[model samples]
Structure formats: structure tokens, C-alpha cells
Target: TRKVRRNFVAEKYAVLIDALYGGRASQYIETQVSYEDGRTNKVAAELRIEDAETFPPGAVKQAA
Candidate 1:
């Protein structure tokens, strides 16, 4: 797993990372921000692992 950081401010933003194997998306990470209310906004982040080589089986770990 990898960690990415952005230093900026915006009203809406999206970040996506896709790992491709065999010409297909085997793993991905996504983050999205959208307006939800006048004072608050919706924020989401997702990580999906489908390949064993990319995401090994064992105790899950996060990159620093």
C-alpha cells in the first residue's frame, strides 16, 4: 500500500490511483469531496484490493 498527500484547498476535489495488471485495474484507491450541506461537505476515501501480488495476505498494514 502507498500513501499520497496533497497540500491544497478546494471546494471539490478527487484523487484516484489505479494499479493495472494484465491490462485491467487490479487495485485502486479513490478519494472524493463534494458539497453536502451549507456548513459541511461530504468526504470519502476508498481502497480496493483484488490482486494478491499487490495486496499480500496477512496482517493488513498501512504505509507511512
Candidate 2:
């Protein structure tokens, strides 16, 4: 399916995922957002984490 299967597989890229979840959810993010009117404005948002599920130990082999 060309997917890395985030559950068990993403741990292979632990450092990168760690950086994403590094701090509190209430942290603010700032970036530039462009509008259709050809004008851009700074945007900010509060980062948050969401829940996900993982496959059972033997379940991963189902694809094979």
C-alpha cells in the first residue's frame, strides 16, 4: 500500500517523531499563510496530539 504503517513502523524513525511530540500541546506555531487575494498574513496555531491504534503482535503478518 506504499504506507510505512505508522504504528509499529514509525519507531524506525524515532528521532523525527520525537521532535514532533517534543513539548506541550498548547505550544503556539507561527507561519505565513497566503490568501487567494494575493495577500499573506502570519498565522498561529496551538499544537496538539491525537490518539491512534496499533496492530496486535502477530497481526502485522496478515499482509503477507
Candidate 3:
């Protein structure tokens, strides 16, 4: 008998909306996993923050 190992890569994207919840913030994130066997999986989540202002402006800007 032989054992096989699988390889996969994961990519993630996230965004934070300031003051979305009355002085708080909401962060949404999505992740995708791709496997060498042509299989794919996706996951998403949303988080609430109490002090989003602690982050500097343009800290999470998109790439050019």
C-alpha cells in the first residue's frame, strides 16, 4: 500500500469599514483554497472591532 500527499494554496482578501456599527467597525474576510487535484474551497467571515481608528489611514489600501 502507498500513501499520497495533497498540495494546496490559500489566498485571502479582507476589508474593514469604519464606523459601520456606530463608532465601531466591521471587517469582512474571504479565503479561497486551491488544491493540485483541481478541487477548490471558499470560506468567509465578518468581525466587529471596538477601536478601528487605531489603524492608520491607507494601511490596507489596494494594490495599484
Model 2 residue 55 distance off true place after TM-score fit, in angstroms: 5.2
Estimate the TM-score of every prediction. Answer: 0.21, 0.41, 0.31
Q: Rank the candidates by lDDT, best first.
A: 2, 3, 1
Write candidate 3's Cα lDDT for 1-64 as tens digits.
Answer: 4554332111112133333435555666666788999999987787766643565786877879
Error of 3 at 20 (Å): 13
Q: What are the per-residue Cα lDDT tens digits for candidate 2 across 1-64?
A: 7866877556554544664678434445566788999999997676565555898787766454
For model 1, how does the per-residue alpha-carbon lDDT over 1-64 read when each residue is reduced to its tens digit?
A: 4554453322213222223333444334344445556454444445453555455677678689
Least accurate 10 contiguous residues by lDDT in model 2: 23-32
Q: Compare the candidates by TM-score and give the number of the best one.
A: 2
In model 1, residue pairs whose N, Cα or C atoms come closer than 3 Å (at least 3 residues apart or on different chains), thus clashing, are none
The Cα local distance difference test for each model comes to 0.42, 0.64, 0.56
The residue-level lDDT of candidate 2 at 54 comes to 93
CA deviation > 4 Å runs, candidate 1: 1-17, 21-30, 39-46, 51-64
